[model samples]
Target: MGLFNKFFKGPEIDQAKSDANRSKMRACFDQAVENGTEYKLAAGYTEDVSRFNYGLVHGSKSKIGSLIVGWNEQNETIVVVPTTPDLDECSNPVYYRRSEIYKAYRNKYPTDAFIIYPDKKGYIAINIFEWLEDESNYIYIDQEAEAKAFTDFFMNHFKTK
Candidate 1:
């Protein structure tokens, strides 16, 4: 019975860990937003696209950290908070305004801006660009439904004027 269950279930979801991570993310978001209203939040592993490779030089994906993205309604901004395993090494929260996000969405070079697509490992990759620095990063979500929800929330807010 144990073997059968293991085979059928694959692996059990770690509810406790998930809850803890969510709490940490909420705290970070609150600190960044202050009194702003939250529209959406999603958790995933993040990587800098520039440093990522296809396993030729190094690994296919170089994960910098785990992160949670939150949409702040009060200031019309998107806040990304790093929930890296190594707390001391975590980067600061990055804020992207609605206008800047929209500009990236409508960029002349589509590959140079915000885009979401499936990764080689069956995860969903959401790419976000920092226009000023010309840098791009990606968040890889394990669940397709969650990725869709995140993308939908982002598009609804930042895809238009």
Candidate 2:
């Protein structure tokens, strides 16, 4: 079993998923290469460990960000570079606190949505995919304009490959 499968629990490695890689949800391994940013699937880059994080290879020196997305097809995965990291927006408390793509949905949808609050460790109770479910409150901000101010702030500083 894959590391993510152990926790995330989704489709297993198979041919159908392999064929899915050609679709909108290309794996991170491909997007990082396309964006000209440094990165690899699953591995984050480190000075001592080059192979560990291929994504960080050609990454920006100023920004630290990552987006673990799923290429539902073929069950492959893609990791886009987010506009910015959460901590960087710390100066603006409100932005850092409740500023997420889901906010846009909350502003639009009329319901008591279940907002997943970060815990004491600064990590949410689940993986990033938890925020990507369609029925769930998760929001995917693809367009720069669609992003909230906080997201825009991060995007402004970080360069997409």
Candidate 3:
């Protein structure tokens, strides 16, 4: 069954389980004093080098901003939340099913590399633009190790999707 296991796949995860996990996580987050800081997955994240000045390129209109990439247990999809102030305050977070991610890679900068993916939007540009001086451009996947962990988990999870 080793070959079959490699070619085939396991059954889909149960929706009930996903919902229960989401509920539990949400409860913990709600009870925390600092919800924003308490989300340890992305504590001191700043930017993704691959997303540098993406909006400045052609075929782009929307300015890039902050991003929060995390797993949404309730929906069983990757959630990309825009944290830029004022710009996307009224906008809803973007959800990407495993099938929606066309490609995923880690582009290297001078000393760091970051995860990048493309969806319906042009490119997954994080913290590449700012309209105001004090606008936020933080990414939760901060360090190279963290980025690698996220990339590995994401790639493995969607390898068959």
Candidate 4:
């Protein structure tokens, strides 16, 4: 029974590691909101969509590190901070302003911007068009609810009638 469980069960969740990651994400979020006028609305983890696969193959994402998304109200910007698996280190934050995102969302080629594939097993890809360098630089959000929240927040606050 023990052997069967060991083989069938998934890897155990490391509570300490999870907590550390959360703390690191929070710190990144805090830094983005350093200005008293800026505040965070939503945050979530993200993965870098592979340059070649684009989820067409099994290994379509580089899961080596994760990114933390932070929303700042003052500047209407989304800051993405990349971090290592253990959250011990982080790179510079990438800022995406509302005007730029809104423009991308309203792009002529709808598929060239934000895309949520209903048949793609809840895969949500955010493509900032030229801002992202190329089509292969899409940011993948794993959680559907978080993705929806991010879209909703952007629309509710920045979308013009």
What's the ranking of the predictions by lDDT, best on top?
1, 4, 3, 2
lDDT of 3 by residue, 1-161 (tens): 89998777744444564344334333333333233232323212234334335465644243445444455333335555544332223124455566676655445463233344555455453222111233244321213454455555555664443
lDDT of 2 by residue, 1-161 (tens): 68877889863444343234222223333433444233222211111112334665653232223332212112122223332222111111111223222221111133222122233333211123212222112223222221232233223332122
Worst 10 residues of 4 by lDDT: 128-137
Residues 1-161, model 1: lDDT tens digits = 99988789755545565456445556666666555345466655444545445566754445454566666555667666665542223356667776544242323353323343222233223443211111123222233455566566666766552
Error of 1 at 24 (Å): 1.7
Task: Please report the TM-score between candidate 3 and the true structure.
Answer: 0.39
- Which stretches of candidate 4 lie above 4 Å from their native place? 1-20, 31-37, 41-65, 100-102, 106-148, 158-161
Scored by lDDT, the top model is 1
Give the better candidate number (1 or 4) by TM-score: 1
List the lowest-lDDT window of 10 residues for candidate 2: 86-95
For candidate 3, the 10 contiguous residues with the lowest summed lDDT are 126-135
lDDT against true structure, model 1: 0.50
lDDT of 4 by residue, 80-113 (tens): 6665544445677766666654332322252433
For each candidate in the order shown, give its overall lDDT on alpha carbons. Answer: 0.50, 0.26, 0.41, 0.48
Pairs with backbone N, CA or C atoms under 3 Å apart (clashes), candidate 4: none
**lDDT of candidate 4 at residue 98, scale 0 to 100:** 62
Better of 1 and 3 by lDDT: 1
Q: Between candidates 2 and 4, which one is better according to TM-score?
A: 4
